[model samples]
Target: MTFDVPDASYYGALITNDSFEILVRKNANTGEGLFLRWPHDSDTRPDLLVQSCLDKEFGVNAQLIEGYDAIVFIKGGSLVNFIVHYLGGDIEAVGLQWVTLKTAWELVFKLEDHEVLLSDSASLGVLDRWIRNRRRKIAEESFDGEQKKWLEKFDRLCDRVRYVLGRDSACYGGDGLYSEYIKSIISSAISTMKEQEDLDLYLNDLFGRTSKPGRSAAREADLIQAIHVSLALSSLDLYNAEYTNHVKECRRVLGFLVALENIYGSSSLEIRRRAIEGGNGRWRGHDKAGRIKSDQIKVGQVKSIESAILKVLEDKKLYRKSDRVDVIAGKIAGAVQGEISTLGLGDFFVDKDLQLFIWHFISENKVARGLIK
Candidate 1:
């Protein structure tokens, strides 16, 4: 059945401090009377009553009254029509309560830095009163099962949201994206528990239906949410570590690239001279040294060498070991020295193999993939 809200302001104006008698007009044939009484005081006006009713209905504390008088009034009404007419329609009354509860839940969870005001002692009392009132109504023969189910759903949603945002911890490990979704499910379960407890007392009182005293689906969900949250956090930590290592690797590569460029840009004679000096008193040959030190290569020479080294280092299959730079550099140096022998500067380039090996090692070890972009 639909309900129509009364004009609270108009009715409030009718109540006066003088306590003057208000008339009750009875329809003799219908045996119905319209009873009217003035508000007790300025503070006890119809607006105050409406506000109190709203607060109690939503399981929130109202500063209007000292206790749960508003809830008492609503639950005290006859089964045919609740006293909601004094305030408004059933839809408005229920809507207002739902809004208030939702608002309170948001406030509780949103303020991560602050304690939940809804859990305050004063607020808990109000919530208790609301729960008791609902229980009483549910126990009555006039109670609607559908309405109860709706209320239960609302409560469950609010509770779940609250738990998810309120608690700090982890529950499991998995991919970052999947972890968050699982965490949400866990939060849903936790919230369900809170809602179920509130409903349990009423259920027991009305239908003698007792809830099993242990963790169930709801608890399992909470656990899963925690696991997911934990997994996400852990994944973030691992990602950051990998990123740091990449940067270091990049820097090392950059250093090696600079060295290779410098070496390749120099004339063959200059390279031969450096190699001879590096060998320290070793025999040097003009043709071999010139071949080893040839600077006739283009930019592509350096690029090709660097690219090959990077590719080798990055390939997990090529470098099974975690240390990538050393292996790539060693292999490149050996290959370059072998190529130099055919260039016919083998005599001038003293200790060509050793020089090439050292150059490759220095370049390979200079930067790491972990340090690079």
Candidate 2:
């Protein structure tokens, strides 16, 4: 189905409130572009990252050539660091300059930053702005009273489109771009704009389908339109995948807690439950039985966690090992690092969360993968 983007020219003017700085990696290997971060962590190749918004994130209807910046968020840090790290030790921090959502969105239309890489059609903003400005000047100088009134009505419709897209003044395209190709739903008639959740679902469904583009694929312009649609749709998919993975982590944590409670004899079931729900405060101290119960959960022999886990492998007959826990500990630590992105408790992730994540990691990576006995 064709999504008629209401006042497509107006979307160029849409702004976003929250913005941040990011590192835009430049990949020297592919000679293609920077190595952008993927939304989901992979179980297969936990190291190899994938996905790109610049190529296909504006939805299947509005694919435009844009650049991507590696945006990393670390806990308890004020600034989300942005750096372009070349493997050969050439690292550019991008000056840690704040880029607005509008500035980021401007990538779709135009990227003003001189140091940033420019796509072949990077001047979309400039070209479109010139067109809009010319049209506006014509309307002001040559239009009749009725024609002027129509321009005013168009402006109002554009405002409505801006609101529907959840854009603030800070986003981008304060100027206008006349998009002749994409159809937009009219402003007043639009009862409701498609929610982000709906956008996410649509993208997921679209990704799995191999059907042709909604528009004709024959024409150059039409083919270009398909690219935009593909990007926007894929971007939504990437955005949704992250949240879905986070929820999956939450569930994994819950299952791990339940299993540990059963195996370890319930040291702090309440804390486990709280962490599962949402981390509010610290969960520490001890139980009435004088057991160690706190924010962290350990599942090993009283003296060595490494020894305890290594025994599991030995018991399963996966590997014959001596009493040396450090051997397996090194490998286990690498696996754990892949699962728990950050240390300590995060917004929805607790240490117990990591505990469960490690459980599922082993279950899938080892047991399910059939790598071990």
Question: Which candidate gets the maximum TM-score versus the true structure?
Answer: 2
lDDT of 2 by residue, 68-179 (tens): 2212121121111111211121124321122332443333223232112222112222333333454467546865665455445434433322222212112233322122
How do the residues 273-362 of candidate 1 rate in per-residue lDDT, one tens digit apiece?
332222211222225445345445444443444444444445444222322222233333434444444444333233323333333333
TM-score of each: 0.18, 0.19
Steric overlap count per candidate: 36, 33
lDDT for every model?
0.31, 0.28
**Total clashes in model 1, counting residue pairs 3 or more apart in sequence or in different chains:** 36
Model 1 / residue 30 / CA error / Å: 50
Q: Please give the range of 10 consecutive residues that has the lowest summed lDDT in model 1.
A: 12-21
lDDT of 1 at 180: 29
